[model samples]
Target chain A: MDWQAIRLSLWLATLTTVSLLVLGLPLAYWLATSRRRWKFLVEAVVAMPLVLPPTVLGFYLLMAMGPRSPFGRAWESLFGRTLPFSFEGLLLASVLYSLPFMIQPLAAAFAAVDRGLVEASWCLGESRLRTFLRVIAPLSWAGILTGVVLSFAHTLGEFGVVLMVGGNLPGRTRTVSIAIYDQVQAMDYAPAARTAALLLGVSFLVLTFTYALRRRQRKPWTLI
Target chain B: MDAHLTPSPQLLADAERRYRGGPTVEARFDIPEPGFSVTVLFGPSGSGKTTALRLLAGLERADRGSIRFGGATWSDAARGLHCPPQARNLGFLPQAYSLFPHLSVSANLGYGLASLSARERRARVDELLALLDLRDLEARHPGELSGGQQQRVALGRALARKPALLLLDEPLSALDRPSQVRLRKELRSLLRTLDIPTVLVTHDRAEALQLGDRLVVMDQGRVCQCGDIQQVFDRPTDPAVATILGVETVVRGRIESIVGGMATLSVGSARIFAADPGGLGWEVFICIRGEDVAVERGSTPGSGSTARNRLPARITALNPEGSLVRLSLDCGFPLESLVTRQACADLGLSEGDGVCAVLKAAAVHLIPHD
Candidate 1:
């Protein structure tokens, strides 16, 4: 049983979660409140991953991260190396795949806030930023938690994107899901079964823990 | 001996409000609008009364307008000055009475005074709890309180800031009718004691009349009329004002005589006298209350009566009041008269029959139309 693959997967998931939250908070905020021109176009693009096949998204990620693309060249210039087949490549792919899971719930949570509550806070003399942090963030904490958990879980379970872009480099790009696939192909049935069981148990425990936490918090769950 | 009157330090300082136009809101009045003690923007639903309160709160900005309060200019479009809402120092109570759901009443009251020292904050919160008669409820969350209690908590929270300008946007409208009346009375006294220029926005005319020192009648977006409640009620400049104030009976008639400085006129199908003197053939609008008319049986005998105006009327319909009967009569043009149930029974008055309608000239108000 290769432990590096498991460690890499955990690292990838953690990095993916952090990056997604950092990038997604602003994006979700914009999606929730922006009255900018062509807002719907941005929304449609953000939602593309939800409906588009994972391989299609993975294929686009491959093209964009490849040396043939402008973004790829910029990354190469800045990073001094190609992004594909690297841990950085796996991290980028996971962030893209998990973006919607983090954003949709957060956006919906922000949207569900009582507009009057926000207005009242402003009238009470709280600044807009202060109101968002003190009133909105706390009020939508459950949804934000749900988003983080879902995004982290989804990133951990990522198969297509990691497989297409990872190149299965031990201790670097080879994550747990790909490791299990490799083990089964090599006729290492016991190791493959153990890795699969670990993944399944982790996923189940994560989902159950979130559900229990949400139930205990008794947050006012909304449909959208 | 002439005593010098000192201008209120607060009055000399005005709160500022800046908005970009989404709702009607309160704007501070450093240079106050003339003849208005507290300009209460009032109208029916969607009439922008709450919007005006929001403007005063600096919660929203007007595309154009100035809000000056407590010797400060909050918003001035031409001068390019706009103050953010909190800087305006407005104690605002939105329509819902939004006390912080998470916090206890004491905590909610102390929220605005976070910058104050702990002891002072506690003292302030305690004082507010006592002031609002919420001492027992200080430890209770907003969800556990009754609607009226929640409103009191919200009021306490707003008042804790000791703001120079107070803006109440239908603060009592959400409570029960009895609670509304009680809280409204309490609010009036509390506001009066503060000496803070307050703007109350409500769709109810009665509420406006009850709460506002000066009423600003707004329709659509324009200020239609702004004046003392009684003054506006006594002489509305337009039919719109008259209608909004519930002074609906407008009888156009020709003046037949001017005796003792009184105009004796034939109105609709009835002869009536008004306190206003006018020449013959003069047309005017005479306003009379439905309760002013006294009903009598047909072919009544002439008797000693101080009533100035009398007309023979046929009762077309009888509507019920609490303990009185409201009779609709065809006395030239349909006239409404209220009589006690006992009077209705004694006079044997029912629908479609004869009756004499008697009223005093003092009971009528006259508006000249040319």
Candidate 2:
């Protein structure tokens, strides 16, 4: 059944989701509020993953993380480990693949906040950081939750990019999607069916939770 | 108690800022009297009244200006000193009552009192809840409250920090007429009790007259006139200022003659008498408020009246605004007069009827035409 691959894939997805959240929040906030002329340039770059083929992006990432590249050489000298075909490489690839899942919803949420509320907070003598945390964060919880769930599920189902970067190494980089492919090639229908069913169930459960949360937000009395 | 022994600090602001594709604001304001007084910046919609308040609160920066509140220099462009809004030690209430939708009323009030101890913060919030009469709704969120209730909560939140100065931008413009009137009285008493210097911005002249001890009239991003409420209303410096102050009838006239400090102005075919507060050019505008002009039907000219100027006019239109009636009259020149409904009924005034419009020389003001 290759349970180790399933576990590795889950771990990679969880780590990628957490890291994307930590990095995407501030980036989305800046994109929403900044009046800079070049803001659309950054937005276009972030949205590239949503339209680009996963294998094409993976090919470029593979080149960037190779031994001859400056970043790759610096990483090797610092950590004594190369990036490609490693779990860390897979995590980074998944984060980039799922970047739009984290940022777009969050940017929309932040832009929806009342500008007057933010100005009032400053007038009440609150620093920008304090106002973001105390006022903006709580109000945008629904959108943030949606972003988190989508990022997590997208990373869980990742295949083409993970395959191109992580390179199908058992117990090291072989994710559940790679395991399913390997099982189908080996004519092992039973384990392939089992892994496919598991993935489907998990994805369905995540979507159900997202929908339930949205419905609850619409009728807040249900929360009490 | 000892702080009161020292003289109150004045707020002096002289700043100019130009918005991209918007109006340019050049403001020069000095309020020598401080402590628990409401100063209204009154003007039309685009006159930069809100801009002036924002500059004072450090919400908007000015190009090459200085703001000094007593000894503390809030902004000095040449010296490169500019304080951020958080450090300005003032409370601001924007036009929209910006209550935090996620926070309860009590939490919203407590959001600004971070400097106080936990117990002290609770005490302060409780005090504001009581002061604003928001004790019963402390646990409710802003969305659950009515518009007036949310406004009070916003005010309480601003006041919770015990700021040195308070700035309000059209605080009552969002309310209905009945609620606006009720909340205005409540807000006046609340401001008196807080005893903090306040700068309020409004396009409404009645609000300025009722709430402000000192009124600054702005037009086209400049201070057109500034003085006590009565002084500004009675004697506007220019025709623009007079127009903004709600003078209904402003007729351009050339001075026909000046006799004994009184000027006879030839407005169209009618001669209007006005006090010549000397130094006025030959061309001036005679400003008369609608309420100040009295209407009498079929009254003999210069009979049973001591008014200096009386003209026979035919009524053109009659508009009933609530309890008062506004009559448009054509006495060779357009004139408007406001009278109570009872007075309108007693005079039996109607359209196409001839009536005499009585203008006291003292009530008629002359301003230099722009």
Winning candidate number (DockQ): 2
Worst 10 residues of 2 chain B by lDDT: B204-213
lDDT of 2 by residue, B1-370 (tens): 9677966448888887789898789667777776778889999898899888888888788787889886798998888888989988888988888888877899899988877888999999999998889999999988899989988888888888889999999999989987875666567777998888888999976566557777899988998887776567655687688678877776667898999998988987898888887656676657788998998767587557668988889999999978999898999788889899999998787899998889898898775532
Per candidate, native contacts kept equal 0.60, 0.83
For candidate 1 chain B, the 10 contiguous residues with the lowest summed lDDT are B9-18
CAPRI level of candidate 1: acceptable
Candidate 1 stretches with Cα past 4 Å from truth are: A217-224, B1-38, B77-81, B248-288, B295-370
Off by over 4 Å in 2: A218-224, B1-9, B248-370
Query: Which window of ten consecutive residues has the lowest lDDT sum in model 1 chain A?
Result: A215-224
Instruction: Put down candidate 1 lDDT per residue, A1-224, tens digits, no spaces.
Output: 67788888888899999999899888898889888989989888887878888889888889999999999999999989999999998898888888889999999988987887777677677777777776677777778989999999998888888888877888888989899999999999999999888989999999999888877653443221
**Docking level of model 2:** medium
